[model samples]
Target chain A: MRRMLKLLPIRFLSAALIYLVAGITLGTLDALGYGSFKSVHSHLLAGAFFTLVIMGSMYQLLPTIIGAELKHRSLAEFQFILANLGFISLAYSFLSNYSFLKVAGLIAFISFILFAFEIFATALSVKDFYRRSLAIWFFLAAVVYLVVGSAYALAGVLGITSFSAARHAHILTLGFVAMTNFGGLYELFPMLSLKKLHSRRLGEVHFFIANIAAIGMFLGFPERGNLFILSSLLFLAGFYLFAYNLTRTYFSKSHGPEVEMDISARFMAYALAFGVAGVTAGFTSATLGFPGSFTHVHLILTGWVGLTIVGAMYHIVPMLTWLEKYSTKVGQEGVPLIQDLYNKPLAKALFITLNTTLALFAFSSLLPALSIFAVPLAIAFLVFAVEMLLVLGR
Target chain B: METLDVRGLPHSERPQLILKKLEELGELEILVEVKPVPVITMLESKGYTCEAEQSQGVWRVKIRKKQG
Candidate 1:
């Protein structure tokens, strides 16, 4: 059981990468006009790749941050198995144009319900609620959003509500993905920099505004003009605040020796940059009623979310592997630093290739000639896989 | 009174240095400047007794060998 527990995170992370590969392949195929695998592509990217990474990271971090043992440790394994099974079924349903999507959706929804229940149970049992960190609030909110998003999706599946596809996507993207990533950065940045956060108050403000903006933007829906501009402005404010806070903290005087340029930190910064660019493009697309806004989607999905996940993996995979392997010998033996566990040059190149490819991909929407960049993106993933394997091995 | 200033050390190095110092000191009381919970937890797991307090946003933890 202990061994399984130790191996669980890596397994989930590995699954995320596999889904990422599948998503990229599907995306490339679609771009090349082979076939429009839209459902499978979107689900793999959002449902499989993004969800797996967030779940894996939260599973590893939640107990520590919340200061409580996981309420149902065994359920995590079940959730993982169900998630993969559900993804397979969902993909098959999409590809075959079959009626199995409902079953797949139900299975996936149940897995998250179990996951959310575990978090809620664990969090509620926390003995010192006052001592809870900022990250907990963000994560808890994300869980709530996940539950809500899942319910909304399930409703769509059951033909209950007139839930538009855009609204569903928004809820999942903003509520689940954006909230989780934003909240995670609050915890991750301070730890990586070995510095205190700039201001908890600002973090709270950012959280509040982000949620409000998310709700406003999604609820505005197909009614695009006034509501879209207002919601986007609010969203932009929230984004600016978070970016400012992070920059302040990063540039602040560290209490400890300055941690070197962590590859993950670079990834996070890039994600933030991409996020800003994406939002701006979205705003322009919305305001001008641009017919072709594939660039906006491309930037958000690849440059923002995808890059963020890739960056986080550089830190998370090595950290987990090191703890599992070398923690006991840390002080006793001359163990390598977490950064030393992976090939940095490869990681750096991977980061560059990923962002560059995403940029090229965004342009590919206008100029189909740019489609060739997908080849390098695939090669970059190969580099990523090799680096990750080396991290696990070394 | 033994003092170890971990203020200048990175997160990865703090605990390692703390444990190393504990080993070197061999039962003498030591004061470590660090984030209290994780350090105290780690020390307790290794059979050490600890007390911690925060002042001016800095946490100082005192560690000692658990007396039989």
Candidate 2:
């Protein structure tokens, strides 16, 4: 059981790094006037990279955070296998074999069901309602989005239903990816800063508004109508609420020396800024029929989701690795601090370069001549991969 | 039973302080503002027993060396 707890997150994070590289490679190629591989790229990053990281983090943290034993512990390893296979198959279908689409979709759908069931069961076992943090609620909601969005997408893929690809993307992106990140930030920001949430009540309100906006936008997309406009407004409102809540939580007065924001939290702060920018761009693109749709998507996916995962992994990887390697030896001998497990200078470098690359990439979307930024973006991802792998080695 | 108040300590300093205190005292209680899940997990993994309870929004965790 201990070994499973130790190894599961590492396995998932290692896999996410692989997918990140592949996804970024394809994205860079697309930017260089190569054949359009947008579908494959999106699947690799969103379906594989994001999903793997979220699954791994949840498996590791949920038990600790919610004060409940994870239900179906043994099945989590099997679920990981299924998730990887399903995503690989899906990526293959997008790249080459259309016949593999249905099979891939089924496999991935089953994996999603297993994940949702496991998490829901674990959460339900938490008899104490107050112990069930707002983060758990976000996680539960994300898995719901995962199952429903994937089913809808599979139906569309199988020609059983006609729907806009954008709608399916929004379901997974806004509902699943964004919600998971929100939950993570909610949990992590407080823990890292050693502060309680600024407004639990406001967070609850944000959750409902975000969910309604996600569903409303899904129902309203491909048509710039009242529903779409209202949903867009709601979406912005939710984002602002989240931003304000977390900002206050982190910046709230500490009785002792002010808790300095570490590099990890700094990354998250920048990620939230990017999230605000992304949603604003998304609203403009939807309401005004803007030409730079790609800008909004890139900002959200790369700037928002990508940075959040990276930031989280910085803290999580070191802590997990420290727990696995040093926890048992604490009193027996001197043990290295969790912060000492990772290279600080490399982390700082990755932070600066990754954000710079994201800014350049966003600009590149507007000015085609600036597409040269893709090379730096790819390099930044490579640096991230290397930095994370190095942490594992330490 | 010594009571170690770790409310304002940096996260990196908490574990070491707890372990050193445990090594010196054999058993102690910690007062923390947060749940201190990681500390509890580490202590248990290191062959210590821990029980935590909350009162007045503060967590009081008792840690003892496990008896053979």
Tell me, by lDDT, which candidate is best. 2
Q: How many residue pairs clash in each candidate?
A: 0, 0
Best by DockQ: 2
DockQ of each: 0.31, 0.50
Q: Which parts of model 1 have CA positions greater than 4 angstroms off?
A: A1-5, A127-131, A290-292, A330-334, B1-8, B12-68
lDDT of 1 by residue, A1-394 (tens): 2342357678788888788878878977887789998889888888788898898888767765654556787898888998898888888888988579789888888988888987778877877543556777778888888888878878888888776778878888878888888878887766666566788899999989988888888778867657767987898888788888988887888775566856777788788788888877777788875525687777777787777788778877876665566656755778877667787777877888888887886767678888788788767875686567567777
Q: What TM-score fits each model?
A: 0.87, 0.94
Q: Model 1: number of clashes?
A: 0
RMSD of each: 3.4, 2.2
| Local error of candidate 2 at residue B39 (angstroms) | 4.0
